[model samples]
Target: MSLRRTRSFALTVVVCAAVFTTACTVASPGSPSPVASTAPDAALQPFYDQKLSWGPCAPYATTATDRTAFANPKFDCARFEVPLDYTKPDGEKAEIAVLRQKALDQDARIGSLLMNPGGPGASGMSALTSIVSGGIGGGPLAQRFDLIGFDPRGVGASMPKIDCLTDAEQDAEREKTFADPSPAGVAAADANSELYAQRCTERVGTEVLANVGTRDVVRDMDILRAVLGDAKLNYLGYSYGTRIGSAYAEEFPGNVRALVLDGALDPQQSTIDRAVDQNAGFQGAFDAFAAWCSQQQTPCPLGQDPKQATTVFQALVRPLIDNPLPAGPGRVLSFADAQTGVSQALYVSAAYPILFQGIAGLATGDGETLLRLADFYYDRAPDGRYSNTIEAFTVISCVDEERITDRAQVAELNRRADEVAPFRSTGRGPVNSLDPCAFWPVPPTSKPHVPQVSGLPPTLVISVTGDPATPYEAGIDLAKALDGRLLTVEGNQHTAALQGDQCTDEIVTQYFIDLVLPPEGAQCKLA
Candidate 1:
């Protein structure tokens, strides 16, 4: 539901690759340049020169819909090996699970097109199936490049994954309302952060957690490029995926062939600023949703005055904190579930109907719908098992963002979240609650900076005016920082490009195929 996005209420909706070749021989197997080397201490020759054996995929789906999509035989999976710690390539290693959908027009195939959906924690393996179903890579785009999706280090289907809370524990944690800022509430929040941090450190140890950040993932990506026989990288990245692409551009500008970055995160914003900006984005999206709900539905659950939307919406769901609502047997909807479900629905305007119905049902004391929405957000299977997306998200965010250990700063961070996102905020007074990153096992690796990558070809950055996860200005800022062109989308969603927006998709397809840059300030609206 967030991008380390602090939801204040439910909180955990934090942010949340591959190669293919027809010859069946080694793809590229070339070593990285000195600047892009795995480490100065060790050369990455062994890791880059390895061959990947693509075979029938092991199941990556934990839910019914995903299972159906993944079962299609069109997919071939491979496990690519990379060092867990780049400094010690000869030491412990992690296996990145890569999935490939072979190009339909193999005769005209160009190369492999690697893709990532922004989750920092979301499963690239899971996203590929959805992308294929939605025809993102199917038509002309898929005909040329083998569409690839890989679960980054410690993500879905990857070896030595980051594991923390059990399914039952996760459920229990979600049931509790989290928007209080009182001293006792802050203390409890700190303790919970400590618990989560210690569990991660104990289960996967500090080294793996430390190495699972974006920098590490991009390194694995380069190795994948080498192993898959691609001399240059053709990539599509969304949301946090944009971060990876920009980082790659910064680290290895010469290796890029084509990159399409949509819903970009401003690389220069600090972690707290990024999270807070995202919170504001959500509130803005929520305002749009509330206004839309008023027009589209009878009696407008948000009431006649759209300006009063935040107060009305809060009145609707905030009571779930003390008195939970029944959803289905063995389940009840807490305030955490209500806000999470709403936030999830706000990501794409297409799902607004479901959101309206859920809120309407909530007004009628039926929370099954909203509860289901929250379930989808958490990836909770019917059997009550969960993927390690959230765990990996926290671990990656901790290492990627500059650490915040100061109590005063944390209090300010909480206050800012409440101020900017009162709809999602508890409306409680200023208070300090330690972020899970405060108790992280290791220091951060990446800091906020404007990426100034020279010698990079004209990259395309797409931003939507109403994007709630990675705001519109971030896109403008990122495009300027990277010296890339910006394609403006007039919409209310997370990402608009390459997701069946005909005009936007055509522009992206043209860019990827011919390396043609969109005109400055090119704009499209979702049809």
Candidate 2:
């Protein structure tokens, strides 16, 4: 997990709101901003905006004993209500749950540091424990800033659950669909996409999907910033959260005081392009993992050579498409599930041990472990009653990016991926196709907006060279777009801030503490 500057070719690789408001009235494009927008809702926002007693803030204190240790140690819960629809301010309202760990150095507190875990749907509230525990970016800077984790709209605790399918049904459908990218694969892909669309439409109905987008949440963030009394927002966002951060900067660039976007994504790319790029990112990470596994073949199960290991992994994927492994009741891993597992595993090198275990298990007579790995990708729990992120992830994504209106476009992308990454291209299409948004009841109020972060505060953008999720190229692109600083980590994974790289962590800590920017092209060495 150590981070270091690998003087190599930047590791190249593949690869890769909301809001609230006091107003009940709706606004349209070119219309004046809502009057009561800055005001808190008398009904919901008041309570959330109210000062906390600082008592029993950590509702999960009981749950934390069995969990990881906290670095800053304090935890409190607060709820803010936001308009379900930003345009229709008077529409139905929803609550967003927030978790706070007040700065240890209260006298020198530097305002709230909002942390996003980035499922677009990831649970920031749960992520508080990690932040407090110093797992993310070492938590030292946290001593001067209260850490705030809010489950974004449609995510955990925030109400109006976005869950589209029960764990069991989702598993069954996945198993029945998703094959390799052959003729049979096409049929399976179509069936899977149709089933996914049907299931999501049946469960979520149509209205919820349309409302969840990056812009809504960004506005909600502004509301939160206002309620918190901070003149500007200090944010640390990862994965999809980077997209959220970028959108916020675009819409309210003036409000960005200090922002750290790790694992950055370029906002200019369409969803289809993002998917294709992401697939490439994973392919790069997998290639790196394969190389590492080859060097450590004594312990790894795949192979002694990277190419051999990939071949083995590809063979493993093909069979799973034909005969999926069953995990818990009503749960099985499909080709798509397997592909997603590989992608997710590549995001964190720590998952390599688990992937190795799963690969070994599959190579033997058991595929349950690998199947469980797939379960993690789908975010399914043993007892079902899903995490609410899967649904939210889909909804917000669709709102921000237009759907694949032409199936041929998807087909072409898959074909192109096959050219670049023969084994990894198949799943990006149908396996990771759009469902929730296709049937979303509402239309986007605005098109995608990519912000130009010039003349802004000195921002620190971190890109791990081998990051398989948000490609390093994105970090480069974003750093250029933001006209800020970029720190490159020579590692094979996703976000580097939390990975055990002392050098990267030190740079981040210094940036937050000193408010200084790294020189252009500054790189953190791998340990």
Candidate 3:
């Protein structure tokens, strides 16, 4: 991805599948539920029955750039109202911001194609703009379907935004020493977690926090489908968005026209298992980066030996634990920051050169480039104001997974993580030393389970073999769970579809245009 594209891509924090079965009967929309009752409450029919008034995309309060971007005439925006709690439909209501780009070929247009760009907290509206403006995959998918994007509850441009800390407070928090695996460190980290949760509850209200899990979001998606007059939903979700897509298929299998889930998240994995898997994945990506760096005779920071590259990289970052390097006038690069910077760059092969330059500078005791990378990961603008990405990410994750409060268990997980990905491990622990969920005000309502969905239209699940965020095994598991066909992209990027990979793009386009399912175990090699 180019720098422009990377910036447009959501800054997802890396805190966070299977096989095929026999084809089941496809259920059409308006048919009896194929799955159990996980849909929106029928009592809230007014909200579902409400009509959308499309107009110019409204400006978000965060930035002028975002405001201007949404003002593009090519995009039409609207707001959808949903209940704060599906269980209490008569209670509070929230507004969901939605955007749409009309299909280029109106005569041959398919229904609206809903898209989500991971983050669980990423702005789908922003993602839509990027896809339409970036000419992604030669815009074949866009030409065939009206692209629909919306912000989930408590996310960007949505009502009741999740706000925990001020920019200044977050800056100070980020600069704090990351806790080691010792008892004292764990205690300190736990205290910070408690403080974070307390602040969030005080700032964002407890009611909204309680309801932002995947289950609620899935319900909201169904409502969107109904309101938009789509008999069946045609959808594409990436990263954390895969969870949303999987849950939708699980709950409303009969309502799917077609779904494509890239960078699949195995719904059945434990929190520790996920963390460990990501650790190993990032380690693999790091090795790939080092090997690539070794071959470059000119701009290569690490010389022509993989082992030496690893040694040098380790030497450069090890000191950050005890003594952080000065990065800028007032900014410093801590061990956590260094780890975050390297991990951010590993998201795409196009970013390897940036990682090389950053690492090379770090080796010479210059931390400027690495700090910039870290800033990008955290979505901290130059002015120091941060987006609510981290805040929303924490709340959604905590509510989706069971809380971890036991110190001993956390320690054990950290030990395994360290062994698996020593270079990427914070040295402090597996969980962010300050495990936010440990002190989450709201307990998780959902547990890890396979989406036992059946009778769905042909869905495509794309998995990148070396994706650090969502591993390949999870994708296989998801495909199996949904009984959907699997398309494997042999690459290290997080999501492969429509990222200029011809094979993956063709498969995805065909699925949307003609409802075609690629052959079982189809593989797309990265260019």
Candidate 4:
């Protein structure tokens, strides 16, 4: 994904899977949140102290090759069945694939460190395997901790997986309607958005949609906590996962053992408010990319200055608005397509190389590489298959946001985008609006409302100075809200935890190991 493109992507901090908010405390959702039941008073009693046996659980995967997909040998695969609706107690159930890595030092083990991979759709199970084996946590900490990942409800390996558009269909839609953002270029997008929305509603039904909100998923976390026999939930959440962590903290404050919310999302804002913040956030990252491109003009395809590169980049998008590239591999890129492509790329610094390469590809008149980047951005594959995430995103988002309340509002929001983000705003409405959810059977669970958290344990929040997704300010707000500390990296990108920011990593490691927070006003500048 292009850094230019990724920066534009929505920084979904676990509200509706893909991605804002303002104020110290946004209003809470209208419905009462499920209060977390406290652990039994004998939570630390001997009965709860069964020694966890560590070994490879093999039946889940067939062979070494299959297991090779995981990052560590310690990972034991298991399936956990969760209620389709916690409200029903004995409601229909779904199986969640889980990955577990036991601590190397059993005696020194703090507890389970559950990790979330942010895509209300990303495979937590798979990510856990990779991170554990590849030493995601690093050091003795890696050896001493048991890291676990689970596919969220309606996501990877979870039963009754919801997919509205086949991968091929979604790929086609992305290629046809997303690459270009103009009205004349997106007839297919309009049709697909409406059709995809309709199909998802039919496929998942109203009950499932209601069950997939942040509240329910947090409940799923609680269940996992109970089953794991952990007294308090120790968690590390990134992007959308931050919202998950916050919700867990809000609902089960006493259950929080240790928490690390990196690239945190502010849940107090409604969907539109959050989107607006992301729109601005991406623009901020683009501005930084522009500045960098300008300084490296000789090697860069876009102009020397940030403004010039932005102009050139927007011009490239402008032509496609009306005359899009030929659809390939069963998909076409629409305005939204471009937005998704750009948005995903900006979330990580490692994507910069790919972004420059793609820009150079387009500048030199070869669109394949950038197009592939767009496909990846949209989760479309060369074989024409797509991840279920896009569909899940649409289904869950419509049920969680007010952005697509009606068609007229959708149109007006698009207009507003043009005004707010003049260069890219017009496309924002088409790419950022809530069309897919407009026709959703159920209304958004409730507007994003978060209760103030006081007297919480020390927490660490990480944000980039020029993150185009969550915006550094949102991180600032989150840090302030949690009464926690913030470590702002002086660079442009999204999450900083695994981005090779040594200063930032050291601070995070220290927090997790020593529970030491960075001093107030602490900041790390890239050398």
Candidate 5:
């Protein structure tokens, strides 16, 4: 089937250690400075004092393909020890899996360019390997610096990985039928969410779950910088990864050499605010897709009238909620499954065609295509095994945000979300009515606050005007908070660095290579 192509970045694609050593105490204009007593407790001196023993990356590979890829001699892997709680430096510890692809020209290497691809749960190691293996565009940074990627604690390949549900359990959860947005439905959804939290707490333990917030990850990044012997950190973060970069700057302003935060998340926004904004953004993207579909020849999958496209789309989805269509031998397209599939496709304009095909297939009584999209979104492999991303995302997100136990507030947010994205918000009432964190075993340790990193060099913040995940407004807020230059990409996509846009590419590359900052209010038109 033909896929609809668009200018948006693909969403369904691609998916930290510490030490205390003398390298940690080295104070330079670009080195992390000592914080006040109220700040996060510093890592134990031994953490900074330890040295990494880098060797073959083969043993750390998580998949057969990854193992084969790691066979390349140039890629080196290692594990570094980090304190579980910075406050308890000498207490329990965790190991972070690290991957490094050395610069091609060692003599001209600027330094290590650390990267995080977001998810707050996305495996940075997988992201880096994909780039090195040419799965994604690496741009000039690949040649200029040693590309460093490490799975944050409680993440892939890292010790104490968050494994809330077994493959079979997760499959059952994903395949469970979702009820419509009635009171009973909402109650059932809440019960399911609570059950998920209980399982995570029971299976993963509260100790590691309590410490997987952005602040902890930022601390880990600093320790990484120290161990890598880089006086300053050169970093790139995408999606939720932007939060890491922003938080890092807040915690260690002096340690930042050059940072690029694409698809920026606003640090000050509440969880409800973020959900509302994202819903609105996705609605806008859907509208764009509908409008585009209307321009197609007669019998367009969504029909000729763009105005009725949303109605048509809703008609196609509503039936799934009541009587899910058979997607395969044993799988069916549940309302929740269809929603997730559509949401993932909306991330990048390039996937529009595939979405169109999937929707068209669904319209014609074939649910297989759309079901496949949902599986991809959930990172479910063909064998029915699931990645730990969803579990990790939930755990880390719960610890980072203020817990919401008030039913009234949740109901209010759900109402507002429905208003923001009517068609897409249909059966989501229950999904949004309760906070996923409410059932978390541990209470939140952090709260939303604007990052206040001072004395940092000029940082570059990229915001795509029509981004569905991290909206442009959040990017504006992030840039203003960091006092960084904002490079706006006037297009529909999530994150715009190194995505084949000459203008965006030139601006970012110049910032990283020459330490140049774009003038205030710089904008790159979609090409």
Candidate 6:
């Protein structure tokens, strides 16, 4: 029952689900968004007071498959407006779509349990739908919580979504060579970045893109909390979703009834630092995978030495930069797609077999498996329409981090990435380039800093020692920052919670259902 893949895994498998067709609570309570214990300005009152009219959710389904999977009679959809600029509340507004999953036992139901699945840009509605279909309906926790999913500002179903590339354009981007950091390569990469930024700005004006950061999403979250009639928020955030939950806890500690952050991202680390750590983490994960492969009954694909796995993998993929292996109709495996596919499968051990098969196909001059993996990573539908996940991912990331314009620093980041993860290194040298965020139309709304929080209820933070994206230490650091309990799971996966581990599920259920906290230095071995 785990849809445990990368942040932006294909939404077709993780599409929509219905909870309750009844209207959401229309209560409008004062919240401490930034200023503690204060009501929103008078101009923002209408938005805060508006009631949601839940209706047939069929139109909002991401795909026909999603509708079929979420055909429960209780499925309903609704939208609410939040200020485009929280500072200028009376200005234009943005829409947030919500999908609620009702509890099996209404009399014992606690408040809504809001779910956000990573991507910073991933569709919460899609995530909820996937979770419900995975059979959360009959669980003990489901009996007491009305599960809720909402598309954050500038995301799917939300008005004026952050969009950049067209389907054709995205396809071209995937086919690109791993743009090395050579002088000429850097220039080409920068030009591409500049064009991407410009295209994003052109597609969704400067206004919507400007206010789509974690801070803005936090504000919108509070409004949803108010309208949903919850005195406090009970949230489950995985991967990048933890970023939002962390901020929400910091800004409105009093509004938190219970919180769980799995595969937590460290708010204390600068953007580049986190990226460097992530590179090393992925390399370590690849090493683990190779070691496991070596122990298999059959001969390992990377030969006898697990240590040479990186070199072996490079040998298979490097030549593709110049000569892409023919895959299927209208598609060929490129170096970029090769790396993208490999990295995607490394997120969870569950996908390791798929990676093995893809690599085997590459050896036989077949690239279809690897190509499918890359397509899945981008959420490219069979008809070629993309889910806008990457677009929102870029824009939201731009708004969340301090804009870096220094080519030297970019080069240094590349140097570190190459140093830590040699699988992608060119062996020539590290090259420098300007990142797309450097040219973003909107300045960053927030910068990396220690979360300022107090009077915060005890929360839960889960980390995996072998997680590739959000490194294990990031989880430890986040728990330290928030003074919350840390659960260390020994595994090689992005996150571990509510994904069907009896140990993790029991702890999480206890926390959310009864506000219980795991003991200090808690740990669980992945089953």
Error of 5 at 125 (Å): 0.9
Number of the candidate with higher TM-score, 2 or 5: 5
**TM agreement with the true structure for every prediction:** 0.91, 0.82, 0.90, 0.82, 0.90, 0.92
Q: 1 or 4, which is superior by lDDT?
A: 1
* Better-scoring candidate (TM-score), 4 or 6: 6
Off by over 4 Å in 1: 1-3, 6-42, 59-66
The 10-residue segment with the lowest total lDDT in model 2: 14-23
| Model 5 poorest ten-residue lDDT run | 16-25
Off by over 4 Å in 4: 1-37, 40-68, 133-138, 178-191, 297-299, 326-336, 406-408, 420-434
- Between candidates 1 and 6, the one scoring higher on TM-score is 6
- Compared with the true structure, all predictions reach lDDT values of 0.79, 0.62, 0.76, 0.60, 0.76, 0.78
Clash totals for all candidate models: 7, 21, 6, 41, 12, 5
lDDT tens readout by residue for model 5, 1-527: 00111111322343200000100011112323333212223446577666999999989876544667677888899988988988888889989989998877677778888988788677788777765654222457777888898898998888878999998887677666544567787788788888888888888888898898887898888888878877788898988888889988988887788899999888899887887888888889888888877776646687888788888898888877668888898888877777777777778776677778788988998888778877765567677877777778878888877787888777777777778877675644544346458888887877779886768777889999999888999989998999888888998777877666778877877777667777766889776
Which residue pairs does candidate 1 place in steric collision? 4-15, 16-119, 17-149, 17-150, 27-228, 27-229, 28-229
Comparison by TM-score, 1 against 2, better one: 1
Residue 184 CA displacement from its true place in model 5, Å: 3.5
- By lDDT, the better pick of 3 and 6 is 6
lDDT of 6 by residue, 1-527 (tens): 00112482223223211211110111111222322243556877787688988887777766544566456666678899999999888788888998887788989988889989888778888778777766576787788988888898888878867778888999998787635756678778888889989998898889888899999998899889878877788899988889999999988888888889998889989888888888888889889888888888877777779989989988887788789989889988988787777787777776777778788888778998888777767777767888877788888888887677887787788889888988866565765777678888878988888999987878889898998888999999999999888888888878877766678778888888877777776777776
Q: Which 10 residues in a row give candidate 4 its minimum summed lDDT?
A: 20-29
Candidate 5 lDDT for residue 59: 91
TM-score of model number 3: 0.90
Q: For model 5, what is the alpha-carbon lDDT of residue 114?
A: 91
Error of 2 at 1 (Å): 24
Q: Model 4 over residues 274-320: C-alpha lDDT tens digits?
A: 66666777766666666666666367777776667666787666565
Query: What's the true lDDT of residue 447 in model 2?
Result: 55
